[model samples]
Target: MKINIFKNIFENRFSFYRQQGRRQRSRHSQKKERKIGKLKDEIIGLRRRYEKVKKLKRQLQHANLDSPEVKTQRIFQGHKDSSHVRKALQCHFAVLGAVKHKYRGLKNTKSKQSLAQLVSDKLIKKYKCKTYCKKLIGCVSRRKIKRKLA
Candidate 1:
């Protein structure tokens, strides 16, 4: 019978490779955990913003629509009347709340971008924009008004 020294060495080397493969997998899993932690941090920040928007919406809803202070706000907004502006603000707040609720657990950038597009579409619909330029102009005009007031 021949002594098979080479076969014994090959078997040992194969076992070493298997152990190294398991170590590599564990290291890869650790990296995935770190990425998940980063995503969790991002989610936390988004949730904070979501809470703030929600609180603002609630405050706006409970506000007295016919008060003297609110009347001044209506004049500067360029809408035909306070009621119309209030409705518009309420509609946008609802849309934003929906977006925040739907995207609360989403971690991907593409999903966030899609949510932003959805919000923009809702804004255009609420404002009754006939064209994209008109919507853009409204945003610019609002900023200009804000700057003048400042």
Candidate 2:
């Protein structure tokens, strides 16, 4: 009977140690899985960036230098002077505000065009700058009004 009690105690201790080892192994596996997940996410981000670079390179190789799109892109790239951009933005905002106030509650297409033309002419006459095109003014004003409504 004493021998049986000793055996039972030993078995119980052995089982407890085995359970502790299993718990530790599971925790280690979970940590490894988290690390693998992070690495996979990082790899995916790198692949996306690599693909974007490759696509841009392909586009550059196939681009037609004489095309209007290329010409416009070149022109825009060349006109990256901060002062000129700032002046243009200021003019755009001024025209936007004036159109907004003058044509309050007017949503008709004809009215929009008339307001744009009026703003274009006024800016040109006042600022003596031909940068503000009538069509551009019309589109910008329309977009702003649309945003306000939305």
Candidate 2 segments whose C-alpha is farther than 4 A from its true place? 63-150
Q: Write the per-residue lDDT of candidate 2 for residues 1-150, one digit (tens) a residue.
A: 999999999999999999999999999999999999999999999999999999999998998674333444555675665666655654554565456655674566577456546555553446544445445543455567899999
lDDT of each: 0.64, 0.67
Which structure among the candidates has the greatest TM-score? 2
List TM-score per model, in order.
Answer: 0.39, 0.44
> 1-150, model 1: which lDDT tens digit per residue?
135888888889999999999999999999999999999999999999999999999998899774434545665576566665565554444455445655774677676456445545544464443244334334334567899999
Off by over 4 Å in 1: 1-4, 78-150
Which residue pairs clash in candidate 2? none
